[model samples]
Target: MQTKMGLKKNEIDELIDKAWKGNLERNNVIALYNVNPIILFQLADSMRKKVVGDYVTYVINRNINFTDICIDDCAFCSFRYNEGYILSIEEILAKADEAVERGATEVCIQGGLLEGMGLEDYKLIVTSIKDRFPSLHIHAFSPMEVYHAARTSEMDFRDVLKELKKAGLGSMPGTAAEILVDSVRSKICPHKISSDKWEEIIKEAHRYGIPTTSTIMYGHIESIEDRIDHILRIKRIQKETGGFTEFVLLPFMSKNNALGRIADKRSGIDDMKMHAISRVLLYNVINNIQASWVKLGLDMAQLSLLFGVNDLGGTLMEEKISKSSGSEVGEYLSPEDMEKLILKAGRIPRRRDTLYFMV
Candidate 1:
């Protein structure tokens, strides 16, 4: 029987072998559309094992979106609030104290780009957190947020990042990057910063010795070619800067969002395929691939271990963004719970920090 994409049996084997041996060429990966789904999955699983091995890492971190009020209003988001729900700096600090009480070593403090707030507001928040909890790593803000801050404050991007670093900002979370192609960005998030701007902010952060993770939110209006290009773009940047610690694959959540209204629905299988394919394609630049349990349900996230994901992502003590978007997964996980989940998946779980240091 002919496969859905008209893939031959032997060609699938050749691609699988190339990926498994870590010698798959970029052109061959782009030719993946002609391969059988089962063969592709098998190849991805093999490559995952060869590269990442059996240990799965989970970080004890808390995600606190200081305010949900956003200006961009991207179609695929559910976390942004209008204005009334914006949390005060004191309220945000209270949440940080709670996170520290719960054994969080890192706090991912981010928010929508408030219209009038300057860079000093961000610096004050970071300074307060640093002054209170000297040990907590403040993995705050994305390039999108940074760009917005720079635009609002009339300051250079590098200087903005440097100030944040001085205020004890630990790292940058590679969010807000839906797809690195302007074509995709134009359709989904036209009001958001351009792809080049996002890249510039991240590259500038790296220049100031701040490490950042890279993410891709796929399975929406983007084509398969665009997805490949996104990965390639990140790989090129990693080669140039060497600042990316891991690559996270975030499947586009489409429940109450506008994109869901216009496009057909996506499934867990699609998410798994992206995770697996990421591992197969980005062999040179990244060593760790994370499965977002908050986006993909826990079961599929657990199953993703076989598909080239080495990290279970963060045990986010409080996650409002994805959950607000119709994600039914729990908001947080204890280190004990992470261990149980990893053991159930037949792998040993190790606790890690933002730097992937075993804790």
Candidate 2:
């Protein structure tokens, strides 16, 4: 059993066994990526079987980006606008109603950090939506958004999270975490929250019992080592808090953005490789490794299942962020479409809510 990369079966098994027990070192984990991609995929798929089985899950969710007006300039973003419309509380609720009409069980809302947006505004968004649809899970705000709210409102980070939880924030979206290395952060999103600060906010959310979805934006300016470093850090936090519900791998969408000038576009193989390697490295610590269909396109997303991915993210009624970055993969996927994609991959498609419970 030799692979194209000249690796042997026993060697592959040795690495896979170490990963299964969570004993693989950083170098050991990095070594997995150097093997023939087919071998890498097989071992990761095997690990995925032991960890999460063959059931593929997706959420019935909608994205409500209330505003595109952002203050900080991230080099890789095309979604921000110098002048953009901020959805009023009524407008935001109306969108949620539309999502409900479309059979969405959850609404994922995150927008640019608008000027004068305080913790109250964040709370109001959650409360207003909750008031209207008490059962709909409001997965709103990233760690940076929460940090911004705390600063604007002049409150402590933990205190802000508590207030938002009380106001009906069901969970947080782990965006704004482009790459958790400060050096990379300085180059891509220098004005954004530091990697350490993002970790702190996520830990605090876990401390307050608010579960969050974790994410990583790769293939832009970071090295392979940087990617492993970011995953290890997330693994450590999950070890401490046990709060992350899932880990989403976002390949940097590099068209029509400032960073596109210098950033290299990731190949489909690289996209699948990232998902596969992440599954092996994080193993049992983060069981749900999701493929971003919007970023990877439906075809590649389906192939990702065999590459150690188990979740298909959400059928966002409308997704603007990726489209803004010149992603022509479109913004919406119907439940039927999602089910078909999952089934075609020879896996069971289960509709999950915000917290991943089967709906």
Candidate 3:
């Protein structure tokens, strides 16, 4: 029962037992931060196997960031442009067409919030895509976008979500939820939605039967306790609404943004630990944990799979947000490349749509 890091058999067994039975206490989860990584990784991988078996999944998707103009000044954002340009409806459709030609099943569309942008415009984007690609899963917009649309149109939030759904928005992206702690958000993204507001929007989306992904941005201006609090909030919502399809762990990329001025570099071990701990913490409540290859390189992403990650995210034909934030890895990753990386990690590779159904 001894691991490579020489941790005790009984201790590892106890933690794993707690995790499997979903009885891991907050104090014990915090204690895992000090556990030997060899033990931590083995236990996490064991839990992953129990729930998802050895099949590692990914999506052949495209990210079409229609614009870079945002009004809010988030400290960690480097993608916002003062002279933001919104793509024409024709231009947006062209990108979707290209994605379909590349064998994509989903197109993830998000952008900076533009002033005077109409709610009708958001609906138009969804309708245009669906009209052309009836079967394509349109995972468009974040909670912030929904909030913005509601404010601009002077309509109720749930009403706005319903209109977008009627216009053909298959799902929503759970961005703008940097951390579910308001104190931390004040320092990172003060102008963005509060934690309670975010939870409200997500729950509303769930009530409308619009499934969305859940996310957390870490490694910048947040404590270990803040991370735990964030996940607990997401877990509570999932227990109630069952709206989240997967949990995505995004490490803060602080190189060219305002937060980078004081942000410290995160070690690879820290990145791996977050993925492993997320799976251990959110075991039964949320099953899928994604390691973002756009942020973590292929090597670290592969290591994450052994630690507790089951999804490698999407085969994004083009990505700009991470690159704008100074991500050195290029944006485009082909399907062959994605499968190769997953195979090297010693797991079965499968392609999934936005809803986690095999495609």
Candidate 4:
């Protein structure tokens, strides 16, 4: 078979092999962007099979935005509200209780950096939930949040992560990483930490024995080179600490936000190409590539499975950020429904915890 980029089947297979060997070149990966879509998908799908076979994994989890009040005004945010409501300890516990009731093994907790919120506030939430439900995995906090809390409390990042870990923080979420390039950060989130700072925090968390899921929010004011640079940085970190559990792709949900005024919603073709490219690029480095069902919508998310996605992300029972940004796909999907989507895609659905362990 020949692709539009004038690549043959054997050449595509060699690309897949190169990815598996874990020494992929930048120019080769750049060339993949122009290849025929089907050929690109084939290359990614082959890599996916080598990594995790035919089983598609999903975690039964819930997103608990403890607060939406943030000080930083990100261009891509519609979820930030200066006067947003903050969930009290009892209220947060109730959400955790509800998540456990619905068979959730993990509760993804992340919120805005309220001015007064510090290490104590973070530790309180984690400890409260862990005290109530010893088994629930508290996949909480982001790099920026941690950075803010450390600064607010005048504590070291290590101390903050240590306290959270003692309070039962299962893992950190690699968010607030719009793009790892400094120029993009200056435009999209000027107040946010620099790319070097983000990497420093991520590496610190890794040194503290915490694993995190990596992410990329593409399709807005970023070139293809920017996207590749972001993934390569993640690969370099993985090569160092092996702390990333999975890499997730979040196509920019361009609606009801400042970013939307400048950038339109990404095309379906862009979604396929980005996810497939992520798979092939991070093949041996990050074993799992997750597609965000909330951002991609259920239909495109399933189609991503063929484009080299091995994980369907999580069944987030409650989500605010994406929806506030104009996602009308609703907040929740049941475990049964999650399986049905994977099964219809001709892949086995397995329940997983935040750590990607079969639940």
Write model 2 residue lDDT over 171-270, tens digit each, in one string: 9998888899999999999999999999999999999989998999999879999999999999999999999999999988888788989987688888
Higher-TM-score candidate of 1 and 4: 4
Candidate 4 residue lDDT tens string, 159-269:
998888888998999988889999988989999999999999999899888999899999999989889999999999999999999998988887778888898557999
lDDT: the better of candidates 1 and 4: 4
Encode model 3's per-residue lDDT on 24-56: one tens digit a residue.
777778767667877678878988998899999
Q: Which parts of model 2 have CA positions greater than 4 angstroms off?
A: 1-10
Per-residue lDDT of candidate 1, residues 79-157 (tens digit) = 7673347777788889899988988889988887788777898898899989989999999899988888888899987
What are the lDDT scores of the predictions, listed in order? 0.84, 0.90, 0.90, 0.89
Q: How many pairs of residues collide in each model?
A: 0, 0, 0, 0
Q: Please report, as a residue range, the 10-residue window in candidate 1 with the lowest summed lDDT.
A: 31-40
Q: Report the C-alpha displacement of residue 349, candidate 4, in angstroms.
A: 0.6
Error of 1 at 245 (Å): 1.0
User: How much is the lDDT of residue 346 in candidate 4?
Assistant: 96
Candidate number of the best lDDT: 2
TM-score of each: 0.94, 0.97, 0.96, 0.96
